[model samples]
Target: MRFPPPNPLTLGALALSMAFPLHAQSDPSTAATLAPVVVHARGADEAPKDLPYSVDVVDGITLQERRLLNVEQVLRATPGVNVNSSGGANVSTIYIRGVGALYPMSMDDSSVALNVDGSPLSTRQIAIGTLDTDQIEILKGPQGTLFGGMGEAGAINLTTRRPTREWEGYARAEVGQDRQFLTEAAVGGPLTDKLAGRFAIRSAGSDHWIENDRTGGPLSKPRDLAFRGSLLWDLTSRTSALVSAERHRLRHYGEQLVLMPYSKPASVDMDPGLFQDSRKTIERYTLQLDHRFDGSRLTATSAYTDTYNIAPVVYDGKLQSALGRGSREFWNVDEAKERVFTQDLRLSSLPQSDVFWAAGVSYSTSRRSYDTPRNTYGDASAKFRDFDTDRYGVYGEMTYPLTRRLKLTTGLRQSWDRKTYNARYHGGGMVQTDSRKLDDSFTTGRIGLSYALTQQATLYATYARGYNPGGFNDYAAQPDDSKPYKAAKTDSFEVGFKTDSADGQYGLNGAVYLNRVRNNHLLSYDSATYVVSALNADTESRGAELQAVWRPGDGLAFTAGVSFIDAQIKTAVHGIGDGDVQAGNRVPDVSRWNGTLGVTYRKPLPAFLGLSAPVLHARVDYQYVGKRAADPQNHFDLDSYHKLDARLGIANGRAEYYVWGSNLLDEQYDLYGYFAPPSVAYGAPARGRTLGVGVSYTF
Candidate 1:
């Protein structure tokens, strides 16, 4: 199932067509037009077309309409993003542009950064639930300058709904397949003429897909809970303050399925006699204040977040047996906490030309701790542990306009980290105990230039540098004299074009980027002791992507998008060679060709139907992932495959129902690896087709 490469122009056009309204309605006052979207990251109320970064904004209405349950599901249609879910739906991870943290070992090294309000959380596990969000902004590229210490590949900023001057609130309920139940409640109103408050709570849970082979019993679905509350106060005519807090919990029990050599795949249900369970918990709080001065403006933000996760995962999926079939049982307990504070002050009175600038400082500190306990089914003890790491950083960014149509932006940041490890071994007469510490620092900078080709078109070129501080690994086979991980760096160069119509009916954005990476860290296991070791390698990636939005007419719009990536190992050493991956090698989890087309129509029905206004929507989507190496040998490959999904729904003003189907063609494909012994232990499997009907009501 191989296909030709996709054209950027075609992909961009298609994305815009589906996203934008193409024509006006027949009624004069009911005409459909493009709406303006503003992003505060740039510190201005400008349209998405004016932002130089690759940004995707998913509105609240769209999320509700789609009945999106979690962050992973909401981001499914987004380009350059891949989500891997463990069988039976307990564990999930997101890879953005093939540039997310593969291993969640430390807090200092994250490829994709996430910020809720102003707080930087420890792990993606904290961002699992679906909430009442005002907007979700996905900003692409190296965000080292503005965010600092994190976001080497980019960042996702989630802004939750806020209280308003007017009283408003909504409560929603939903029921779905697998005995799934969902409930959400929200309230917002003015506490006083100068004060406001808002609160929201959501709870969802269901049954898992795994069925016990022996007892023919179903497992419990992971319990999901989320709660948020906020308050705003107007101190003076020109000053305001806000405080918000949120909490989430996810609890589940069970393990994934694995394949064994010379045997069929099997799911090793947990030993009920041992009484073992897994759980992940998260808590976060945020506070911010804004003040407008006569000559200068000052803004301050502060937040704290804590996360705890414990999973007794085994290296091999096979269960431990009396004969020792290379199977082992172990539990990993990871705990992390982060505290951040930020402030920005700017002077905006230009005496000469229409020019102004802003300068700010950011500071953040984090601590992480991990412990591993080994259990041979029933009689195993603790093996290794790492106490924690203390990390902090500072950063700033500024923008200036040389002319009305020409502007420039520059940013810089510096970060430092310290780590400590603790060990306890109980295999043989190996009494190994030691503690190591390392202090490292790195700087990242960005420079960009923009030009307005026309009122509706703009072109920009940018050069950005990204870096992350390395730290200690809990499991390294080589216990004696193992070097601490070192810092890694990447530099990117890019140029792009952006266009938007005067009426906002159509919009297009495209970029081509080349990134050079040094000291890239990779994991390898030692054959003798089966100890995992970290290796440093050099690599480079080059690619291009185009995304667009289109609005053809009232109740009619479409969107399409595409991307092409070519990544390879430039240099290799230590049992890792450069030849295994040649030029034009497609990066794993990234597709070479993908696109989606959709349309929606809403109109007034005839009086005979006894209905007021009825709206109908249908969409067709197709995505193709190219074949690539599924193993280190580079010989074994997973064939490329395509999937098509469609949906039809009817909605009125307050309540809506829809029948949705995914993988309509029932095409069988693998989204990730299919490991078979000696090479890798676990391989991700793609799910089959599913049909479901859902309805939602707001009161």
Candidate 2:
């Protein structure tokens, strides 16, 4: 199944050929223009063009067109964003502007805040079903004033489609390589004079593509099911209420971690019995209420989520072979459960006013429990831990017009957090228990000024401060490793501009930023001793991003985005290395340069048979990711790589069909790399070329 690496010259020729339209047709009287997208990540609804920071939006239409199955795919084409996943549906890490946690712990929260329908996500290992998406908003920068401590880097906000009064529905089916099949259906309409309801469901299953050399069969097969339902009711002329419920379940045979020095096509030379089975289930419910006055609006939201995951896995990949044993024996059965509850209340003035203001208060609580049973060389042991966290915050922001074309904005937030942990270990005729508590209170804010250079252009500058709270490491087997780490803080400054052409055919956004971070919480793993710890250090990061979209006549559109970042450690800490050895090292998992280019074209066809007018569409996409360091000392580096995708489709008002190919060039790359037990290098390779066909019908 291995394919030769693509030649640069051949790829260039192919890209050029695909960029041109296949069939030239007369231009329609009405030319489409890029629409202004509104975002709610800033604690208020506002147009992205009016914001002072770097923000990007991906609509549901684009998601359908791209056939994106996960958040990582959606973020790869976005500017100033990077995603690293370890060959699982939910195990993903996101980095923005070189600010991210390279190695995340079970208890340590992420640097970026992830939200679905205004409810914050507590765990990064939970699946994000994209069955009925409305839009995804990416806000890049320090957002501590509104989003709390996890917004040190930025935030990702996902909104799902709501019930509409009009009757509408769609059904889609897809078939792909490696025995993959997917089906999705949605229906919505008015249930009564003042009530509307919607329901959506998605189911998918795929056989493993990677093969195990020892067993001569596929390594892992995965299956998933998800369901969502929503209801909207108008209680009165000025008041309304909405409620949503969702459930998702996933089961997979196992995860395949390829050994270092492996050849292309990703084959594992290990015992099939060493693999594990995994299952995950998640459920969520949310309620929203709104009331309007003459000049202002009141809003309230409440949400609850519960998640459970279990896996039986082998800890050492090469244990049987390295120990000269004939069978696999060392293993661990792990289980994790989490429950979260959140509520938020806010009031804001109408957006049309000269002076805009919003204030909100939020309260959230989360509980997590973990259990693991290990069997190594006939020795048995078990470990259990529980964590509870509570957070409360009050935040407010205001924007005042300084003159006709100038405005000043400021925001402030005060937050308090408390966390408690309990651990129990039972092994070797001994039982031990430990308990600890940690708490912190802090203040964060943002200030900015914006000026309109012209009717179509705006320039802005901002300064913000953000922090990630400290937490105790649950994986620590020793007393010294159980201590809580200090909180990490960042002071950031950014300057940016948003502009549109007078003819409304081109748009551009760009930003330059500098960030200084202190007491930066870092995760370190000792493969030899199987111990994990957290430390503190100082780091500095500087970056710039540019994005542009162009639309000419004749049904043509093009988009290009690029980003450059330089992030390095300014001070060395314990467990990394000597002071000078680690001080100047490049930050792990941060790429120096990344970019994406896209081209799309469409042409209408003459009406035929009873069918209405149809359109032929073609698209090409390209992405480039630069080299990245895998460790603190920068000894191991992942080489730069590029990927290309293309799609050809035909569509009308009610039905559509498309053929799509991802990684058309068959480029080989690593998603991420880490040290396995016994200092073995292990990584997950990116998927190879995949070709699929899909059809959808709407009624």
Candidate 3:
């Protein structure tokens, strides 16, 4: 398939924002195992069977049924992916194939690139809910040829629900333990003969959920709100144009942490005098144009985003200092504003023959300014920094049939990056200013071969190179440490197979991969000064993954996925506090093994008791994460834990009512923890158990 198949129907009116608008309804596949899995990761719609690499996809119905509202929840069931969130979305870090560093996180480049629709976004900017989404895809391996620098491990793409021809809409309300509540609604439909429009809104919040020892009460509350709108115009029978806009605001309080040895679940002991709130706001806009030719399509996408964040905290976990009680608090006030713009143009062949090709060029620019107030030291100390970056790339990829049973794919890309950095510091017993500029270039490519073993099964192997953009340290104490750091790189190799049953009752797939890393990025925190500096080293990671889906009988489905990884620092003569870790240490915050098992069943009930026919729905999911090192030194380890989630519901054609539970066993485990100042340890206790009730109505 090409891109979205054009329809005769289009939007009829120019709807307002996310208010009540004329609605359009979209439907999901009723059968799980037989549903077609098509993706647009390559600038066109195609099945996973045609691609040589591994890409996992989850549709909207699956997300809604499981209540996977955020990236953290979505990754639990995805093989070879992990997340470490420390209190808020801005601090969340994601690791793929055990490559990304999980060191409390910063607004830096991620090993896995994050994208919305066809545009790029920073990993730091997307901690919000994934509401009104059509599907989410994770393309594993080094996606160097098409996605540009930054995706050293892989890439994530989130596709939102688009407007349909017919009038339809949906509304849902959910309430859970601890006063957790969420509401969502979306409407889409034709506004005119040639135009279609869509609008969506999502809101979620929770009262205090974590126990506090000092106040003898619960702490930490969270609030989030988001809105999105889209307009589509069928300029002609062969061309279409789309415009989209979004805005999000989030506010949160409390760290939800427990005093060290990782002993409790959702409990903390602290006496901080006052608590400050962390807030983030984002605005985004995009325009896309597509034109279809006889056997090819041309596309152009442009996007822009503006983001602001403010986070303040108490560093000492005490109220002993006079500065802690007054205007001059003993803490830090961090604030920043960032702006980004990107453009991409491509022409892809909608081949009638057995040959396919795509060529594209992309350009992006970013600028950010940040400040830290003097409260951190309770003195006349502060830091201000500015960063600017530009990136450009050109890429081409082609797949050609070599013989009846074999196909060859080749891709190449050339990328250039330029960065300017500036920093100034006052007080803290030091005053300094630093300014620098750096430019770098890379050549990345992939080559693969695929063989058809049978009509429903295929085997393939590929090799690729990936690049991660270099960055500067804004949280530095000395001028020397403020200079930009060198970029990290990776070489990856993978072999995989995909199979589907002839009757479409089952599908199975597996892949094995190995990666060689150069100058991998890591963070070293200074104990005495509480400063963070960049650390670089070589490393190796190898893993195997298996996934399967089976439909044994009508109205019953089973899904399973498992992964095993051995990721270690190679030349690990890197400094941590006062000591250097040797080679062969496991990567921090990455699991050695993980797996997911899930079952879903739906049956139609015979009409009885003065009732029409209704559908009964039930689903259960189990997740496991293996042991992981807490830090590079391997001084402490986090134990493995298991989680079970269940849902039971009744539904008609347009209405559904459900009850759900997560972590039903109340398992105890640590989400993430670290030693502050290299001595006092604090950990964010994982959530214990929560239950909720929900109702949804769709047209």
Pick by lDDT: which candidate is best? 3
lDDT of 2 by residue, 1-699 (tens): 322233343344334334443333333324244556678866566877777788888888778877776566777667688776766654566778977764555544577888888888853643566788989888898888888798988888888889999998877776676656677778999999999999998877766666666777666667778999999999999999999999988887444456665566567665565444687888889999989999988889999988887765443344445434444434555677889999999988876677888899999999988767554533245778888999999999888889988989899999999999888777677777878999999888799999999978999999999888888775655455667878888898999999988776889999999988887767676644556677777778899999998988677889899999998988866553211227888877789999989888888877664336667778898999999986665667877889898888776555666888888888768877765443456677776788877766666
TM-score on alpha carbons, each prediction = 0.84, 0.91, 0.91
Instruction: Evaluate model 2: give its TM-score.
Output: 0.91
lDDT of all predictions, in order shown?
A: 0.58, 0.76, 0.76
lDDT of 1 at 459: 89
If both were scored by lDDT, which would come out higher, candidate 1 or candidate 3? 3
Cα lDDT for residue 619, model 1? Answer: 55
Cα lDDT tens digits for candidate 1, 1-699: 111133243244334323433222233114234357776554434566555667777767566655556666655566666554443223444445555433323444466667666556543552456588877677777778766556766777767888888877755554444445556767888999889999988776554433333344433455678889999999999889889988887766333533332122123444322213566667777777778766656667777776666654443324334224554533343323333333433333222224434456655555554444545443233455554565556666665776889978777777666666666554464556767778877788688888888988988888888775677664542355245765668787878888888887788889888877676555444433445655655556677878877877755666667766665555534453222333334444445454554454554433233224445555556666566544333435656677676667554444444676666766545444534334433443443455655444433
What's the lDDT for candidate 2?
Answer: 0.76
Query: Cα deviation of 560 in candidate 3 (Å)?
Result: 0.2
Task: Give the clashing pairs for model 2.
Answer: none
Q: For candidate 3, give the lDDT.
A: 0.76
TM-score of 3: 0.91
Comparing 1 and 2 by lDDT, which wins? 2
Per-residue CA lDDT of model 3 for 1-699, tens digit only, reads 011121111011111112332233222235334557888778778878889999989889888988888756787568798776666556666778887753522476678888888888787764757889999998888888888776788888899998888788777877777667777889999999999999999877765556655676555567788999999999999999999999888876533435565444355444434343577888889999999998889999999999888776444343212113433224566777889999999999983447889999999999987778656546467888888989999999998999998999999999999988888888757878888898999988799999999989999999989877777876765676675666888899999999988877899999999988888777777654667777787878999999998988768899999999898988865566645767888877789899999999878766454335467789999999998887777767878989899999876556666899978978866767665443555557666788987777776
